[model samples]
Target chain A: MTVDLRRAPAEKAVAWRRSPAGPPRASQKRQTVIRQRQYWGRLFVLPAVVLVSLLIIVPSIQGLYYSFTNWNGRSATWVGLDNYINGIFLSPDFARIALNSVCVVLSVPFGVALSVIVANLLANNLWGRAWFRGIYFLPIALSWVVIGITFAYLLSGRGPINGLLSSVGLGMFSQDWLGGETSALISIILVFNWSYFGINVVLLFTGMTTADASITEAARLDGAHGVKMFFNIVIPQVRRYVELCLILTMAAAITSIFALIYTMTSGGPGVSTTTLEYALYTRSFSLGHFSQGAAFGILLFLISLVFAVVRLRAGVKADDD
Target chain B: MTDRNSTIETDTSNDVPLSATPPRVAPPRSSSAAHRTGGRRVGDRISALFSTGLTRIVLVGLAAGTIAPLVFMVFKSLTKQDGTNAVTFDAWAAVLNGKLPQAGLISLQVSVIAILVILSIATLAAFGFAKLSFTGSQPIMATIIVLMLVPGQTFIITEYFNFSHLGLIGNIPAVGVLYGVTQIPFATFILTNFFRAIPDELVEAAIIDGASYPRVFWSIFLPLARPAMVTVGVLAFIGVWNDLLIALLFLPTPGSRTLSVVMAGAQDTRTFDVSQVMAGSLLSAIPCIIVYVIFQRQIAVGLTAGTGK
Candidate 1:
């Protein structure tokens, strides 16, 4: 390649302002306008681009570098693989938290299935549809802290579930909800479903609207009813939406659950509810182990980056299509 | 019976038709009558009735299950859930005194600052993406979409490092800036779709008329994109208002606490007083609920823009 380095493109010569003779020719002005647009366009986007880099990119790189060190947010020493080893294997709760996160995102299908049902129903020919949708999304609109505290109250030892159980003469079934190891994770998952299912309902219901009524009617005419029609016909047709739902749900699970966990169980009942995200919090802030926390953050970034890239491509492709 | 198609029709009719994420459902208008009364025969009607009945059952059940927590919190906050036989507003009153009010103030302050920053930056960025193609626009936009898609947990620790180094953590405005930056991608995404839907001719006319790019953006497109701007603003408001994890990490001391931080504190130290926590949480949720009830459609439109359509 012949390196002919010019500070400006060839268009710059022609794109400059023409003399004020002959009322400034249209073509020259057009090129100049185009050049102006490009300049302003880049300038307009620059602030945000800089902010994103300053906030996300630089910190991310620093986080990676610090992960290999023994930085405790205050001081530092180079420690090779120590933080990663301690975070993953040596630390008791780290592995469990990792497993817990995997389990949470792994359970995306459960939330999806549940929301799919409600969304389909919402999309159905039912009265009070608006009311139902509003109620469904009520939880979503509320802060995660509010929902977490509310559920924590409900699932607390002497809370409403027990109150209901005892009131119904099923007092024997009443036990510590958040206090129990097994129940803690389950409770978190249930709350997770409760909080997020609304977004999926909205998205999928919107998707369901796009389903061809003619095809559905044709299926109905062919004696395809209920479960068979929905499973074979309706569900498969909304592949794009299902994919979008899964992506959003997974991302929400990993990043947004910190509030819920922090308020609900504090990743407690002996680390049963701790996930990688929560571990990042305690490790960095509570434990003052910035390097380990950064390691966890890097791992989290890698996980999110893969999903993010896939989602980005999908979104771009969908837009292109 | 005919309500099925109406939701789809109504959803878009309520929208800006050229919405970046156009909820362009299949035009079911042509076949609505055919599908509805087509099923009027005895067996089909019966099945239809059965399904509608079934749908009602499921919807009612689902709503009950979903709304139970909210109802429970409200009820318990106003009543006595603790063993002491006293019905009182003390829990609500207690939270209202120093903690809840202060937290609410901090939250409002943070969200206000955050919203301004988000809207200003997102609008400008959206204009670049939608109207003017510049060098690296594609990659920059791709970077934005990727950033938006990823879990924010990835770089929060980095934020922590940055904030700690600058001694800026616990500063509400700094938290606001962070919150605002986090939302730039989504807001820009929603706005870009919104801005692109605007006719190119409009921008061209302004440019040909000698309006500068910024002038055209400010005077022509911004006005056109107001509904979208509102939608993006409402969405940003909700995200920042309800944010907990960021506030939890950044605002540690009670002096700097947002509502969520205060509520989380209640959950931590006052585990026995569930009523107080519930009351505090309910108070914190009021602004969010009010905003949501008022702007649910805009929020939905913003969230599903380009994706849902």
Candidate 2:
């Protein structure tokens, strides 16, 4: 492929030389320009290549190697599959943590649904639509630490949620939202959706604009309205966007809930809120089990890899269309 | 696909009835049709009004839901935590006068450095990928895009091991470098897409004027890509400023910790003050929120640039 791409410009130069109007010197100059461009391209990309390789690529490979060995920060001994088998799979807390991760993944559908609904609603020609978009997207501006701290206070026993419930005489419905094992996980999921659905809404709204307006109008004239129109006409049009949202939400849930879990629950209330990423941190950094942490990291990477591949394939297909 | 079939069915049904109607009864049919259409217009008006009202209500509710938590955070930061209902500025005062300002300064320095590094490296790479054709460019670009999806957490352990071995764990600029490197993939992706949209004729015109490649990039591409550069810079700045993981892992000491790390640490203490922590959280979030409000359009463009047509 590289060879073909390289030779194509040269072939074009040769074709130019065959034309009576094209002087030989101009073709020679064109070849030199192509050579200069190639040289500049390589020069410009050099720094990025070096930095990414040293920081990301090299360490990732080293991490894969470390996952198989008993590497404790200092020295390493080849322990084969012991870290994966005994350190992770056989550990008592692994099942619960994996379950927590699964729960996070399950929340993606709800988030995607909310985003699609909200995006559809906002897609209409309405009053203050831009203001609503800005408001919905406000949380994306805040850091995860700030979000975690804000929610940690909001879901506490004496927080405004319970306070409002008590004032409204529905106090029984209000519990410590982040206090229990199940409640903490649920709270984390809810917060995750709340914070991230904004960006999804933006993506889906962009998708909605790309829908064939004439087709939608045709569908409307054919006795389709409201839910039927949305599901049958609009949803089909934005299917790729919906898929993109699902993959992004799932990937985020799997990998990027660290700060939220750290601040809100600390994987606490007896490890009910601990996802794989959180477990990776605790086992490796806090407990000094570096190899075990490496193993967990690999597990997390593999899970995310599935979504990445799906997204890449979808992207390629979209490009083809 | 189902909608297309439904559309065809409705089309044929309406078409067959119109074609089968006789011309002799057209006048009477026209009069009755006008009456039915008038009544249907009124009904349609009412339904449109009703649906519009419903949409307005739902939008208002969603907007309120989005803002309520941030508002509550601000309110909690101001009020006393003893259920006394007395408003106090002590938490804010403490956050400003205590360790947070210093932490904020550290975060600012790190972000500034990261943005500089990202802007310089990502812009050149993006321009190269967009305008200059070279051997292996396609594969290299694909690798960069793939790296964009891989979370930084996957490599944190290895980075820690490496950084520790190099005795650079607590180095502030090293953290900035790591932050800058992780962000290069996304920044380059956005800028490359932006640069590719600019017409190639402009580059050829500049070249025809005897401008060298670097000169063309410096004078032509740089001027035209200013907005994209700003978008990349703001995003890179926000990303570095908002990151807690790298800052926490690398700069573990009290003096070098970023604002987020300090805020997280404050929350972890058993005797932590709730109002003060809330104030601190708000304090750390202020810079990012301000940046977001100022560069809202660029941020939106940068974010959705890759996802849409």
Candidate 3:
């Protein structure tokens, strides 16, 4: 690819030479221009990369290194493995948060599948498809904070869900959704799905639009109707899109704050919704164990990195084939 | 799942494909079946219209449902019941009075500053990435892609200490710098792709006229990259404005708290002014929506361009 990018000038030169007007001198001039462009292109991208390095990458590395040390947020003295030891082996919160993170991850695939099914219906050009698509996607752009607040309202004992339930004579099912430990994690996961499904729906809808109709037709001709055609033909065609959505959602899920937890429960009735990001925040900023926070952050980073690597490697391999 | 046959056949029957046409499945040629269903009857047209109406109704209902919370929030901001459980403009007025507690003014200031700084850095970085390719360019690009893929929270704790040790804790600059930094990976990624989409030949033509890299960037690429720039700006603004965890950790001081932190803490209280809370929420949302509206066209175009590329 680099060689091709470099040879673009030469390729252009040949094209100019083969033109009907036969502008030989112009082609030579064009050749010089291409050579110059290559030089300039490199210069243009330098500043952004430098800033990215300084702000994101360097601090990340520092954090990773600090994760191995026992330095306070204020002082700089490294005691190797102390922070990590405290964070992982000793801290039960780590295990609970890890479990919470797992729960977060698990919700996304279910959400993705639901969104795709909804997206397929929207894509079918049935009545009001565009409006449905818009509705589904509206929440995608909302801040997690806002969603948390909204869901907090909805899930409250005095909130609308409870109000409606009592009105419908099913008040027994309505409990303190965000208050109970067991239900809090489930509530937040459900909120996440509601918030994110729109985006997945949009991506899937777009992917469905691009799906070759002939492929579906071919399936139909082969006696593959309905579910078979959808699963075998349509789903396979949109695998790349599904993967994209999955990776994006996974990344978001890992990094996302416990906004609802912060708002409604405060990581209680007992740390039920304390996600990796939330746990890191509390340990560092709230608890003032800066080193421990940094260590947890590194652990969170590593976990996210593992998932990211798998996603990227898969994408690259698919691209190659 | 509904039969894919009905949907696919109906869809394709209306619009034909241009290439690699598939074999068509003919409808059953039975007059008896048609008669049973009253095919070609006036009622069929009415039923089709009825289904269309039903779909529209459902769509409208869902759209309303989706937007209702936001709408209610705005309404809640305007109604004044009391200091607590009240939905009124008083909360908004109080916030605007500039005497409100830690979260309001500071959050607004921090968010504004963060957006400006992020936009500047991202735009510059995008310009560089899109138009220039230095040595080891492939690796740098790959690194960026990797960075973007990595969940942003991975580095927050490190960044917290990095800034704190640098005496940037509770500092507005630290907040801005952190927001700007995390956003760079994605902003640069999106913008670079945008920059790349500008025909190379156009840049070469500018150079041929003796225009320098800076000159070409200013005159040609900048104008053409407007759609992309807007998209980046909107995304950056939204991300920075809506950010909570980072701000909560870094800007821990009462005076430095962003609105999210303020709201998060406020929920712990017994008697809350729901109206004021709604107002604050609306305030947070307004800027994002404004940016979205202003750049909607460009965002759409940029999104399509990014997806296509």
Candidate 3 lDDT over A191-282, as tens digits, reads 77777777777777787887777766555554454455566567766666788778778777887655655775667677778887777777
lDDT by residue for model 2 (A236-285), tens: 67777788779867877888878889989989888899999999999987
Candidates by DockQ, descending order: 2, 1, 3
In model 3, where do residues sit more than 4 Å from their true spots?
A: A1-43, A76-79, A210-229, A316-321, B1-65, B78-120, B253-255, B293-309
How far off is residue A99 in model 3, in Å? 1.8
Q: Write the per-residue lDDT of candidate 3 for residues B240-285, one digit (tens) a residue.
A: 7677777777887866888777766656668666666667677766
Local lDDT at A219 for model 3: 51
For residues A1-321, write the lDDT of model 1, one tens digit per residue.
112212233355444444444344665565567667777888888898998888877777778788889886677888888888866668877667778888899889888987887787787755897888788778767888888888887777877799899999999989889998888998898889777788788778877876667756654554455676677556755656787789878988887788889888999988999988888888887878778888887788788878867877876664443
Error of 2 at A27 (Å): 3.7
Which docking band does candidate 3 fall into?
acceptable
Q: lDDT by residue for model 1 over B1-309, one digit each (tens)?
A: 133344333433454243443233534443445666673557767887888888898888888988888887877788775566477998888777756898899999999999999989989999998898776688989788667754566678777767988999889898898899988888888889888888899988877787889899888888888899889888888888888888878988768988878877777673457677778888888998998899888877765665544
DockQ of model 1 vs. true complex? 0.39
Residue-level error in angstroms, candidate 1, position B73: 1.3
Question: Could you tell which candidate, 1 or 3, scores higher by TM-score?
Answer: 1
Q: In what order do the candidates fall by TM-score, top score first?
A: 2, 1, 3
What fraction of the true interface does each of the listed models get right, in terms of native contacts kept? 0.67, 0.60, 0.48
Per-prediction DockQ comes to 0.39, 0.46, 0.32
Best-performing candidate as measured by DockQ: 2
